[model samples]
Target: MTEPRLRELAVADLAALAALEEAGQVQPWPAERFEAVLVSAQHAVLGLEDATGLIGHAVLARQPFDAELEAILVSPARRGEGLASRLLAAVISRACEWGAERLLLEVRAGNAPAIALYRRAGLEEDGRRRGYYPPLAGARREDALLMSRPLTEG
Candidate 1:
């Protein structure tokens, strides 16, 4: 594996990003959605792409006083490679630079890996939304775990 380098996602990367998200996320954002985000000042889309291709990506929304981690996806084949953490750090750095005081995100309750990753990155569970995720098959629905991290020493 080549060393993963992070960069602001370019328009050409949308197809690869969409594929990665569709494979990794339960409800992935379509390519046009990401494309729209890329052009907005309120959104920051970052990607980790090496010689092979895009391995991970994160979409964050910039607010006046906070930032929201809207979506994060790492190719299933690229898990456990620390790409997620790197992408997260990049997003956090961008948010901090933009003067955000906190970072927020919602994760599927059943996504243990993502929950663990966010926890390790200093996020704490602050709330929950029942039935936030639609059922995949049967009557089982997934909750949404709200997580937050303070951006500055307080």
Candidate 2:
């Protein structure tokens, strides 16, 4: 396998993005939502592609004072290979380039791997939204874990 390359994604990549989302996400964002991200000036969609095509993606949205990690996913088949970490690094870099004060994200409380990844990248737990995610595969609704990391030193 070749090294995965990162690049900015556009609306033309919607089909591959949707397919990857469906394969990787328990509750994937709808195609319309992906389209919105692709077209929005406030959003950046970063895609990681290898010889087989897109293996991971991260969506970053710029706010007035901070940037939010709207979504991120690596293909289930390709997990544990550090693809997510790479995507996250790019997101943080982009946020910093935009002069964001901080970067923020919300993950499912039950997503241990993702939470760990965020923590390792210097994010701290901010709060939680109880039952923020709908039940999956007969499981109860999961809380959303809010996290953030400063982009600039005080």
Candidate 3:
């Protein structure tokens, strides 16, 4: 298999991104939503792909001072392959290049794998929102843990 290359995602990639989101997330955003963000001026979408196809992606909403990591996912079958880590690091680099001083993200509290990934990337838990994530199917609603990492080391 070829090594995945990271690149700025385009509007054309939304359908594949939607499929990856659906396979990797409990509640995936509609493809149109990604298109809106990709077309917006203050947001960015990044993706990683190999010879096969898109295997991971990150969506970010940015301002001059900070950015919100709206979503990030690696293909379900590709999880544990360190793809998330690489994609996250790439996003952090891109965010700083875009003049963001910090990057923030919220993840389901019970998502240990995802939480660990953020922690490994130097994002510390800074806040929480009670019952932020709606219940999935019959599962109970879950809290969201807010995490952040400063773009400039200080």
Candidate 4:
């Protein structure tokens, strides 16, 4: 397998990105949504691609005082290969370049691996929204864990 390259995705990448999201996300964003994000000035969509095509992507949004990681997904077949961590590091770099004081993200409380990844990256739990996510297969909702890391080293 060829080494994956990380780069900014353009409008031309919409279809491939949408396909990856469909395959990887339980609640995938529509192609139209991806299109909108692709064209937005405040948003940056980064894609990781290899010879097999797009295998992972992350969405970052610049805010008034910080940057938010709106979404990150790695192809199911590509999971456990540390691709998500690479995408996250890129997001942090981009956020810092934008002079964001901090980076913020929300993850489903049940997503242990993702939470662990964020923790390992120096993000701490800022708070949680109880019953924030709709049920995937049952009636009980799951909480959302809000995490953040200061971009400035101090």
Candidate 5:
């Protein structure tokens, strides 16, 4: 696969982000939510684009001492191409630049690929939330695995 270009998302890319969220997330954020995040001072959103289109993105929320990776998604067809890793790297770099001491995120318990990617990015399992995600089409609920990575002064 060719290397994708990463950039700060533009207004035109919001629709593509929405589409990717809908395709990847069971309980995807509404379009307006993404729009607000894009414009909000506290959020940093990055998009990855290839020849096909927007392939992946990561949204992070900044606080005084920490940043939370609120969402990360890659188009299903583009998985296994390291798009997720690239997105994660971009978010972490932004978080560090924002003076964040740590970066945290939660992944659905069964999302092994995401967990592995986070682990490879130096995050560790810090905790878990039981029944954090609503069931998909049934009564079963999903747990969420909380992970965190600390940033060092450079």
Candidate 6:
């Protein structure tokens, strides 16, 4: 596969983004929510496409001196590759360009793989939100772990 290309998302890309998001997430975001992100000025939406096509995506919502990662997904068919890590690098790069000093995100407490991935990318365990996520279709509710990383390197 060719190196994935990162591009800013447009309103028309919402459908494809929604599909990719749905495929990767246990609980997917609705189309309406995706549409909102695409049109929101305060958020940065990026699409990652390679020779095969839309491989992954990332979204960052800017705040005063920080930003929150709203979501990041790599297609189920493309997981375990470096696609997610590539998307994460792009998010960190974009966040720095947007003048954000720090970036943070929340992940389901039980998601060990995701937590490990973020830590590898330099995000440290910062805090936790108790019972933050509603249970999956029939699963029990899970807490959310907040992770943060500085945009600048040492």
* Candidates 2 and 3 compared by TM-score, better number: 2
lDDT of each: 0.90, 0.96, 0.90, 0.95, 0.89, 0.87
Instruction: Please give the RMSD of candidate 3 to the true structure.
Output: 1.3
TM-score of each: 0.93, 0.97, 0.95, 0.96, 0.93, 0.93
Ranking by lDDT: 2, 4, 1, 3, 5, 6
Q: Tell me the lDDT of model 5 at 104.
A: 88
Estimate, for each residue in 84-146, the C-alpha lDDT of model 5 and write its tens digit: 888888888899899899998888898888899999999999999999988877868999999
| Candidate with the larger lDDT of 5 and 6 | 5
Clashing pairs in 6: none
- Across 57-148, the per-residue lDDT of candidate 6 in tens digits comes to 88889999998999988888878988788888888988898889898999999998788889999999998999999998778889999999
What is the TM-score (0 to 1) of candidate 5?
A: 0.93
The TM-score between candidate 1 and the true structure equals: 0.93
Output the number of the lDDT-best candidate.
2
Better-scoring candidate (TM-score), 3 or 6? 3
In candidate 2, which residue pairs get closer than 3 Å at backbone N, Cα or C atoms, i.e. clash?
none
Q: Per-residue lDDT for 120 in model 4?
A: 85
Compare candidates 1 and 6 on lDDT and give the better one. 1
Candidate 6 Cα lDDT to native: 0.87
Q: What's the C-alpha lDDT at position 63 in model 5?
A: 89
For residues 23-107, write the lDDT of model 2, one tens digit per residue. Answer: 9998999999999999999999999999999999999999999999999999999999999999999999999999999999999
- Write down the worst ten-residue block by lDDT for model 1: 133-142
Tens-digit per-residue lDDT, 1-154, candidate 1? 5698899987878788888888887677878898899888899999988888888999999988999999888988889988899999999999999889999999889889999999999999999999998887575888999999999963
Return the lDDT, model 1, position 84: 94
Score candidate 6 by TM-score against the native. 0.93
